[model samples]
Target: LSLTLYALPYTLAERIAGPWSGALAGALGSGGAFFLFFANTTDYIPVLLFSFVGILLGFTLAWWRPVIFYPFIIIWNFLLFRLDERRAPAQTPHLLHRHSAFWDEFQRLPLVGLDTHLLLVMERNRQEAEAAMAYLNTTRQRWAARAAQIEQDARQLMACHSIAAIGEAYHRLSTSEATDSASALLRSFSRISQDVDAAMRQESAYNRRLALSAVEDRLDGLLRELTRSNDRYAARFRPIAAHWREVVADVVQQLAEEAEMRQEIDNPYIIGVPLTEKQEIFVGRSDISSHIEQLLLDRRRPPLLLYGQRRVGKTSLLNNLGRLLPSTIVPLFVDLQGPVSQARDHAGFWYNMARSMIRSAQRQRDLILPPLARDALAADPFTGFDEWLDQVETVLGEHLALLMLDEFEVLDMAFARGRLDADGVLGMLRHVIQHRPRWKVLLAGSHTLDEFQRWASYLINVQVVHISYLREEEARQLIECPVEGFALRYEPEATARVLALTRGHPFLVQLLCAEVVALKNEQPAEERRLARLVDVETAVPRALDHGSFFFADIAQNQVDLTEAEVLRLLARQGEETAVPRQVLVDYFPSLMALENALIRLQKRELIERIGDGYRFQVELIRRWFARQPA
Candidate 1:
């Protein structure tokens, strides 16, 4: 292709100018011709040879004046093309579109002629083209008018809600001496923000015309205005929102002064109160509760397993259950990390349980477990635990006890000898499950319960509840709750982008929202304005870099492996859409250890599985790795 374009000047010069001009043109054009021959030749020999020839030729021309080179070639080409044209055959010029058999015609005739027949024909075609353009213009105008009318109607419908009232709060800040007044107005607007939102959604849904482009744009605009208004309202009132919360609580207390607070349903669903900015807590475990109730609530001897990947809220679920259970149900929550080093026997489990039970009893203000805690500490931690359990059962007479151990897989005997196959703890759990009538064991870990069952063999009738990723609607609701303060909203594409990036992980979702909130904080007053509570732009790559989150512990872990090899492998495979297992094995010879390392890395969510291999879990990390010097 380069040669074709390169030869054109020489060919034209030879046809019109003369041989001397064609030679000068060809010599001048040799630089481009060199590129064609030198294509893809990066090897040392090829590069060295080309460099030698170029240098030798350039030195040979040291005596010639380089400045006159361009003009001399141009003059020479002018004579060559004139000479070449004379030798060429006479033919009518025409543009042709090649097909297998049939040829295509050009709208503009190529043959030059000065006659009434051709002139009249060309004039008629020009008129037809102008008429088509005029018709298109008329159609466009009609569509524009219809769109404008739809927008007007949609805006009017939007105005019927409190969105405009809330939006007014944002505009109020532009004026001086109205900041406090704006805050007050924003508070007033917050009281009915959701009501206004519900109304807008109803209006948007019922109006079929909103599906049209004009109406849809109008609807979106109004929605955004409302969101910005609410965000402004939040920003204005944030300092006082906590105080407002106390005031609301005081009011609720006053209303229920005569009633029992515990019996009454407190506002668990944060529908009206704006969730505090930067306040993070694990909430909403209805599924976890339901599974617990079905498998362990009424059972006499239940061996229940609650398994999910690390940080999937397995511990949170158990804590929620502990809060909800009655005093009659003795629930002991234990962090199982201690057992691997200290819990060599049943004595360890008992001692660990005693302290855990004391904490729970203290939280509940129950005096029933005080003596048991003290008595258990005096004996071996294991013997003390068994004695305390018996004493508690004797005191409470007929109550049931629920022992919840978190990260229970750490107790595996395999992990004890620097492996993960622990059958001893599983046997102890099985013994408790079979022998105890009023005791139920709830074991939670990052791995599946079947892993424990395989080792124990005696863990019969144990119910396994698998905690999976949240459904789309659940994740959206979770995100929507936190962003209400920002009044930022996400377009559907933006929502999907966040979900895809985080893979609907709860902690990851919170991290993304925090980043967006930080972005909003850094913007200037004019730039800070937004239409939605969780807009995509605030979460886009330009909005934030999540690479730091992925590579956070890289410095810490670099000492464990060859930093260069680990980084190189990750840099290559992590950015890949998918990496083969063999590629990883080849990259890291100690792949068995590397696999374990990768698992630990996955728990941190620095990478995610793509079919058989993995990809960087964060986009910024992928891009960063891609740009690294090889």
Candidate 2:
């Protein structure tokens, strides 16, 4: 009976701690029981000896297999109770009552009750631990699946070769949900893919093949590293690595075959394409940039009109304004020729504008602007856009927002098509200029405000900044040193001849120089380094051939019959000679008609008046006209 009472503490310790702690606790409890109840008794020696041995055996069994510990302990205590009753039958009832009273008192004790509550809490904690582990495993599995999907998509993107496909892939990668490292790695590959495509377009086939081979080698190395990696993050790129390497190897072989068929090398000059902010080919435009800065400082914040003819580098200048302006001024450039003008309604227009503004702010200044969702603009587009701008202003703090709308004429065309309300758009611009102290509006187009009567009223006090052909020195810098490590050099006479032919027209100069480079490359290795007067003369026809689109636009789209006639007559007079107004008048049916044609031609920047006569603005253009059918 005494041993049965002592076993309770041993069982409790086992439940709370483990078998070793239970054994230690049982030994202490049994020693106390022996000393307190049967210290000098030898009559019940067998029962006492059996109780001690049973406790040892039970605890030893518990240590070996904890599953049976509680049952074994209960049985051992029951056997001891029977043994106590049999040995001392006369005191059985008294001993049982004492045992019952002691158990009731132990259960009532605060520490014992508290231990029971702790056991309950521990059981609850065990359940919670299992639940947490299950959740972690599920999360890891989900991430593994996501990584697999990203790998598959990346492999498909790697197989794409066309610029349009690569552009679509980039858009998909940029907008899709992805891990940061995965997104960054895919964007890097997208840029490399674009470089490969550019080499195919601009360099020789042999060079393109070399580029493709290099890409293959790079992919192969990445495959080896990814295959060996055991990290979870590396899993995102691992599945794509081997397949991408295979695709690149196939592309390299295809390119090598194409190179063997016919290898034609294109010159490095970038013709017709507007220089991006990343391109180092853009030369000096300090004057225009300085003028813009001064206008930005004006307190009234008048709307600016950047007027220039087509292909005069208006877009390029706008693209680069973020670099030229103060860091406090953020340039949000929007090409109205793109999706902004193609929108079907006001909601689409404002949404596209807001999207462009956000993108440009991030890209140019690394500043995050408040996002304007399309759905937010579905109710009231203008109001929603205005609210978004208010949030953007908060983010900008002390910065000024320069809103540059390039190819504003395209938006006007949209207005004419009734795709957007001209009044609402122009009124918004006027309101921004007048009401928003931190915002400035600049419109870039080929035509002046007077030509667009609808814009003239809304944009009051418009400050006109004319962008024309490069200044002579700027043009010379562009020709001689378009980029660092330029291999081609021009003799003094050859450089003068190029300037005479191009008249510092940016497009014409690039076109002519590209042709000159192509011509030089075809020469002997020794002759290829230096461009002579003969080389310049030789490149003129090729330049005219390649730039026919630019010249044709001027003849067919910009000028009417009367203006075309005037230009052809000027061309016939030669590059150095300026045909007088009287000479043009005799050719026309009436003087009024000739004067109007001349004014229009001058507005187009196709011809310039020198003292009472007009001549072609660019000699290369004159040469194009000289080759045309009379």
Among these predictions, the greatest lDDT belongs to 2
Candidate 2 off by > 4 Å = 1-152, 158-168, 171-200, 203-266
- Candidate 1 has a TM-score of 0.43
Question: TM-scores across all candidates?
Answer: 0.43, 0.67
CA lDDT of each prediction against the hidden true structure: 0.48, 0.73
Using TM-score as the measure, the top candidate is 2
Instruction: Return the number of clashes found in candidate 1.
Output: 37
Q: lDDT tens string, model 2, 563-601?
A: 999888999987678988787777787888888988898
Work out how many backbone clashes candidate 2 has. Answer: 0
Could you tell me the lDDT of residue 109 within candidate 1?
21
Model 2, CA-based lDDT = 0.73
lDDT of 1 by residue, 455-512 (tens): 4476666677776556666677665554233344555676676677666656555556
The ten-residue window of minimal lDDT in model 2 covers 105-114
